[model samples]
Target: MGRKLWLTTSAAVLLWTGAAQAQDAATAQTDQQDEATTLGEVVVTAERRTSNLQETAVAATVLSGESLDDRGVFSLEQLQFVAPSTTVQNYGQGNFFNVRGIGKSEATTAIGVGVTTYRDGVPVFPGYFQTEPYYDIGGVELLRGPQGTFAGTNATGGAVFITSRNPDFTGVNGYVMGQAGNYDNLKFQGAINLPISDTFAARFAFNSEQRSSFHDITGPYSGAPGDIDMNSVRASFLWMPTDALRVLLKVDYNSLDFGGYPADPALATNDPFEITANGPHSGKDETARVSLNVSYVLDNGITLRSITGYQDGISVFSTDLDGTSALNNTFYDRVEEEVWSQEFNIVSPDNQRLTWLVGAFWQQDKVTFPVTTFPEGAYHVGFPEGVLDYYIFGETPKETKAVFGQISYDISDRLQIQLGARWSESTSRNENVYTTYPAFGLTLLQNDEVTAEKTTGKLSLNYKVDDNNFLYGFVATGFKMGGLNAPNFYVPASSFGPEDVVDYEIGWKSTMFGGRVRTQVGAYYMTYEGFQVIVGDPAVPLFSSIVNVADETVLMGLEASAQARINDWTVDVGAALSKSELGEFYAADPRIARSGTCNAETGPASPNCLNLDGNTQGYAPEFTFNIGVQYDVHLPNGATLSPRMDYAHIAESWTSIFNNEALGDRLEARNLVNLLLSYKTDNWTLAGYVHNATDQTYIAAINAGLRYAGPPRQFGVNLTRTF
Candidate 1:
């Protein structure tokens, strides 16, 4: 019902305002627009070649730098509110990002991720490395559905591509921005570009942000748990020795110090801005990455490109698992990860009847993780109420290699066909050991090797109805590699199989009323096999493992978005509706599978090994939509004053596959509003924004058998200058 209402309302608004429009009176200014003419064409490299977004068959959302700033999106998690069929959730330790009801939700480091994230064309490892402040970015592209042909492994759900500004050889230019707001929030960001000769240039960017904690800790440990202190820097260089050859180098570094876990007491109170922890709680993250890209254009209109990238990062976090003032449970986790990759590509010119690209990619990744737990006697009586410190030290080294090729042929002036395929193989080895602090012979060791391979591809056909209307249909396949679980969890079920998906999609794109209005609608249906599920052990609450269901799962969804320029007001609206159901499968509910009672005839009697058929996937909301309007008011002082308001709604979603409301894993629906007012001139600008204007409280994650709340209402002010 809610989804229907949102769709109806959005359609009505667009239809009513579609006919009334003036060229320059109230213009919808976007980053890709020229302002002098109609809306400029948006170009994207999602297919390894620059192409008009309206002509691309892939379902993607492109958020330019200007759009991000106007929306005041500072973190990756906040992006979900603006994009359809996306969700980003965080608990005390890590973040989980999902698109179209597909993602991983667990506290393990051995398994691969379902969704892959790339920064400047380099894949970002999971955990802390994936969460970073968004500053000085060129644009962000969120691709939905199967993207295996272009994104390589671990892209079953989709991929996120973030591009940073590159060094330019066109004179000196830069910008600086400063922000201050409630809760003692402060931020500073700046960039400088310098041309060191006609062929060489360098650009440097930096960001520093500090914010006070919104949660007040009151317990044995009395300190704020939500404070943030982070700094990041990037340096890029461009060298063009000749017209045919170009070289680019980029280096990035980030450091973060979170005062404590950003979680409040769950099930104890309704307040989302208070925490009670008795154990030491803090988190630190550090990363350094470097990449070199070289491109050479041949005289035959063929281009050769090579990308070399290396990254290393570390994360240390401690949290109180009990979410109470009593020191009953605490745990600490540390992770060190490093990755190296090299890719080579050959591309033909785009002007010919046949455009093609061939690429080869190779990547190596290694990681180590350690954990310690402290549980008081109140929870369990298996042992004395003493600190049971355990460590998980493992070196999971993996090598992945892939060869992919894509070709697009224009059969006629109004019809085109594209076909792509990728063959990928991966080999991994896990040398792991689990040991206790006392060394009382409580140790576990494992040496495992695994190899997997898959062939994925996409086929699409596009038809142009006219110069301003287009239709497309495609079928794509995606796969994610499987891995072994830690021995500390369970030995019998130590490994899980790979997961795969097949997606069928159809979409339409249109630019109506002389480019004053742009709209897109896409519908997708996906079939999943060997769906990997991560869950906690019923007998041992602290242990987690992954399982692959025997039956197949199905998911279907529709997404629509529209942008309009109506005289003095610019309006943007988007909506998504999705329905997912699991096939018949047997699973144990952690909340009910207690007492440790099990037998062949009475399997897991306490919880009762039950069928999870027809259950919805975790965190897959059925309805989501957002609407925003910006009105520009011309001033007599030759400046502009703009006021914008944005609203987003998310329907209730399950946090666990069990789908039992009695366990409190289902989060209720929430509605949020944000407002921004800005005064702009030629050289400088000032802005004030209020986030979560309604001050709604909602659950963001259900981790460690407890719920974590999202942020509350907050306001901020920003000033930016350009030179």
Candidate 2:
């Protein structure tokens, strides 16, 4: 069935591409270029060069401003259709990003995922911040496969980069948008650009959104509620102090507060679930970021650039495992994190065939989490005699430093080769300070520290079939440093080592029928070593932690996509297939001797037996595909109507690396459809969209026998005015 669907989709795309080419040829002879022009040309800096999407050698996808606005894609979660191998899942209050079925899962302390996220050319401090807001975004770039040598650390799976609208010095331009939807959802956004002078400019933007939940809980309580409120503002200044130098400074602040329904388990019987009538679980997050970029064009075709940034954020979240459970049964987690980074790079101009970039980066991150678990009716239920209470508090601090360099030489006009390398080192420290009432006799203080170093590299060869066609092959390596686990009541913490993977890929990029049709195809194989897997014992509580269990895994995949323009209509389609297998996964487990009874008052004494085998990696989906179509209609009144449709299919996947039967289940395939309608005049545009139009029932993420359901059908209308 999958193969048949793949063939049908491919045939349809090829037919459309052919039709677009024929139309382009006929129009080339004449000087008439009257098309709706809803799809604008996308410009990207994926390779640090201002080039069209079809001109880049790297396997990348670009989402233009028009597409973003028309689809009402205000967050990274809404960009699933922008690429073939990309999927975003939310676990707990956090987000997990997967590319080609490879990504890290959410945890208090673990670093196995192989992807990195960046905003406006600067890497976000930690990998846990993938859920950052996407307001006032100009475009998004998805670079597939390992990009360690080019994008720095954590690029084993891929890299997602977002660029925001910058200050414009040429003219005064701005836009305002307002939206209202079901569930009493409201949103407002606006941006303004000021041309202070020929050498100075300023831009400011702000957005606010609020919405209510769609699910109703009727278990034990009536009027259970869910709500989300978010606000963000950014201000930027551009100063051209000299003709050869330009500086940009930006400051952004965001705050998100939400209260929502908890994860409700599927009942054995078809009984309606109701809440216990307690307060809803809630999460609050606040972040502030400041960045400065300086670029200097020196003599002899050399340019120097520097990016410096700092981020500070704090989050408080509470989860009620069972909605009918009282508030005392809830779990509370509070986290605070601060990060700082600086990078400097020098690049040679494109005057010669040999172009290169060399840079150095330094970053530091500190995160502290305080977790507390309470029994049911801790506040109301009378404390039983001899009962005990406990709290867990820990802090993790990581520091990273690296120096990287890349150089590309054109062996000939038709063939070019590039090589790059990076040497990086990281250190992590975990400290846990706890207190237990009734003198539980457990250790109250513990500390662990781990450090690792690695050198990653990339090599690529590009062969141009012609100006409109090219083939490329590359090999790259990526690494994620390991860290220590916080001490828990049941066991002492352990340190882990770095995990690494090498990816090999061959791809082709072609602009077939003139410049109106573009297509890209690629195949890749990856091998991993020392893969990190999280393991826990269901028999014993508080045994969940990360361990380097398996030594190897092999992943192979193929991807293809195309975009074309036929008359006033545009179409885009894509598909991906992959298979992954683990080798020698049974060697990591060992039975340990127990020193004391399981219910001993002093807890398991001395050393406890640790079993760490047979764990499947998390968030690796075997098959996924996305297909889209868009068209534009020009009316007699000079107004244009554009509509777009997108369909996505995701195959079964595992949610955790440790393949425990209790935690492992095949997530059935899901079909999601989205539609958008928009009208545009000379200077104004109005749009409406429906997401998950099919109202499918699906799970966004699952772990440890728990699943987080995906959002239901949602429809909204947006109004925009530009001046």
Q: What is candidate 2's lDDT per residue for 1-723, written digit by digit as tens? A: 478446744764675566555755644643344333323556667566566665555677787666666555677676765577777776544567778766666554447456777787777756444455677778888888777876665777788788888897878999999998877889998899999999999999999988986566554432224578888899999999787898999998888766643555432122222334343365667889898989999978688999998998877655544444443344455677888989898888976899988888888888776454342212111122234434456677888899898888999988889898999888887666443443466646657678888889889988887886778888888888887655566666666667788999988777655456677887889987766655443224434455554447777777788787756767777777777666544321112323323321222323353322323445565566677787788897899898988888877676654344332344556788989988999878888888889988776665434455677888888899988
lDDT of 2 at 680: 90
Clashes of 1: 1
For residues 464-535, write the lDDT of model 1, one tens digit per residue. 988877899999999988888656634432777888999999998877656777777888999998887765
Error of 1 at 172 (Å): 1.3
Q: Name the 10 consecutive residues with the lowest summed lDDT in model 1.
A: 376-385
- What would the TM-scores of all predictions be? 0.92, 0.88
Off by over 4 Å in 1: 1-37, 222-224, 264-266, 370-389, 435-440, 488-493, 536-544, 594-606
lDDT (Cα atoms) of all candidates against the true structure: 0.78, 0.68
Candidate 1, 331: how far from true, in Å?
Answer: 1.0
